[model samples]
Target chain A: MSQLKLNTEGMKPIYVQIAEWLETEILSASIKSDEKIYSQYQLAEMFNINPATAAKGLNILADEKILYKKRGLGMFVSPKAKESIQEKRKNQILKNLVLELVTEAGRLGVDENELISMIKTSNKFVGGRDHERN
Target chain B: MNVIESRGLTKTYGNLKAVNNLSFDIEENKVTGLIGRNGAGKTTLLKLIAGFLHKTSGEIEVFSDNPFNSIKVSSNMIFIDDKMSFPASLHLVDILEAAGNFYDNWDAGLANGLIDYFNLNPRQPHSSLSKGMKSAFNMIIGLSARCPLTIYDEPTTGMDVAVRKDFYRALLKDYLQNPRTIIISSHLLNEVEHVLEDILLLREGQKCMHMPVEELKELAICLKGKAGIIQELATGKEIYHKENIGKDSAYVVVKNDFTEDRLQNVKLSGVEITPVATDELCVFLTSRNKGGIDDVFDRN
Candidate 1:
């Protein structure tokens, strides 16, 4: 759980980074659906950030319906939290990275066919590696 | 609700105005960083709020009463600085006991725990401690006081890196338990930015920008690309800092008001955009000129 070392130098704000990190934890199944999540105070202490900032991060997830509050108990991950997070990341994170890859390829005089082949090779290599580990 | 409010607060030191017509409100239960360069009237403004100095003109209110020499304000507020000194005759532990009697919300247990944690020798007098130890002691008091309005002006002056880190964590943890209006004045925003909810930036005794810390991170963005493209794109936009990267490339910081599509287009045009860090953005905003120190070097 100590993997929350934030990139203070990155272009993304800390709260957004926190929200993304929690989504990542959920996606990785470290936190399961209907399970209690870290409170704002806990996040603040863990990250050495302002409680308000941590609260803001939690509120973002809550607003997205990935988390729901249970009165005084605290926030719990939604049952569909993983699916929603996956959908959001597909539309946002994966798309942005792909866009960057394509743009860089275009700048380097990489044709669409060559770019597609490179992506296919990379995907196969990564998939085979993961399968081997499994 | 606003825990502190100043209307055109002005404090003049004979021919010089240390605080000039500053008007801002600090909401309760929020940590605000009073950030500025040296001689930027940060201390003067904090003093005015702490009721140690009187303003030449204008008005400042703490808890709806004038803060100047007000008994009500003094009891409810704690101001910690490097210059804070306890009675010469009192031992460190004795001073803690006295403080316990003074503030209604004093947490003796927390104070003792922090004392043991820092390994502070309570038997020694305040003056006998090292600079770093003295600062740690002052911070201990500042935190244990649990005042409604806590003002810390560079409370980490002599602290080492580890001590500073622990101090910030302790401050944040305590604040979570007992929310209050805390103003931490520091020139180094990078160190304190994450700990702050809001930032009240000052420049030359005037308010520069006051906003949430998150919004300030997105206030401007740095763009690096071909000189022609960057210059053309920056036209009619508010440029905070600009410089020639090499011969054909230029780097410019401009207001981040671009739509997603425009930003995408800028990327397509080969312009790299990076978010301006809080400290760097403050430097750009408070810089006297767009050229900065390079202006002095580039007299061609």
Candidate 2:
């Protein structure tokens, strides 16, 4: 958490970044299901941000069911949290990046076939063959 | 509960109105940033709230009582600035001890810990420390006092970069542990914006804008592209700033009220959109001219 450096210049707000970072942490299995997450105060202290902003981020996850709140206790990761986060990132984040990629490819006069082949070749180069088979 | 409230609050010095017809309510347990340019009446307004200065007209309240020399307001509020001073004969440690006597919430342990952490010589007089060290020492007292209504008017005046960062973090941590209504007036909003829940922006002794920090961040957006297309899209919108990039290109900052579809179409049309930073937005909002300093140098 101490190594988390948010990009203050980007279009995304700090709370959104914090939410995404927490999702990534869960997806990476660093925080297991039903594990307690950092409180707003803890996140605020770690990020040097307003506690309200940090709480907003925690609320975002709570709303999405990626995290749940226990009475008198802090937020904890929900069961299947990683799977839900992956599903969300796939639909929102990955889709947006692919949209931008396709738009730029079109502007560069790269046809659909060429773009598809380029993606496959790049994937292979990055050792994605095992995932590809899966 | 409102810790401070003002109604048409005005203060005058000779013919100049330092704070003019300002009305606002500062809620309890929130960190609000009071931002403005130099001589923007930040200090004057803060002094009025701290009971150090009287209002010439209208009304100002601290804890529902008139703040002008009121004992209740004076006892509950602590105002820290770069010019904070102590008696010439009092040593650094004695000054801290004296400050503890004034505020009921003072944490002597925290004060002593901070004094030792900053490596200040307890035996030395307050005036003998370097400029940066003096500011650090003053900040220690301000934080340890833990007054309900704490006002810091450019409290980081002489501190170096590292000390400034440490002070901001410490302030935030303390505020979280003990909720209080805190107002910090500063010129360095970029560094302190993250710690603030609300911002009260002043321009020429008047309230330019006061809103939550999140809303202020989204108040404006910048567009850069062909000047003709930019002008076409910017029509009927409030454009706060404009600058020509090249002969054919232009950059304009306008209100961020456009709908998602409109922004997508504008991007599809090749106009690049960018978020305006809080500090930049403040500058643009308070700027006298749309062209800024470039207008002064432009002979055309």
**lDDT of every model, 2 decimals:** 0.93, 0.90
RMSD of each: 1.7, 2.1
Record all residue pairs in model 1 with backbone atoms less than 3 Å apart, i.e. clashing: none
**Model 1: CA > 4 A from native:** A1-3, A70-73
Question: Candidate 1: lDDT of B279?
Answer: 93
Model 2: per-residue lDDT, tens digit, B153-213?
Answer: 9999889999998899889989989989999999889989999999999998999999989
Worst 10 residues of 1 chain B by lDDT: B286-295
Scored against the true structure, residue A32 in model 1 reaches a CA lDDT of 99
Q: Which model scores highest in DockQ?
A: 1
Residues A1-134 of candidate 1: C-alpha lDDT, one tens digit per residue: 34258999988888988899899899999999999999988899889899888999999999999999999899999999999999998998899899999989988999999999998999999999999999
Which regions of candidate 2 deviate over 4 angstroms? A1-3, A128-134
User: On a 0 to 100 scale, what is the lDDT of residue B64 in model 2?
Assistant: 97
Model 2 lDDT per residue over A1-134, tens place: 45357889988889998998899889888999999998999889888899989999999999999999999999999998998998998998898789778888988999999999999999887777677777
List the DockQ of the predictions in order.
Answer: 0.78, 0.72
TM-score of each: 0.96, 0.95
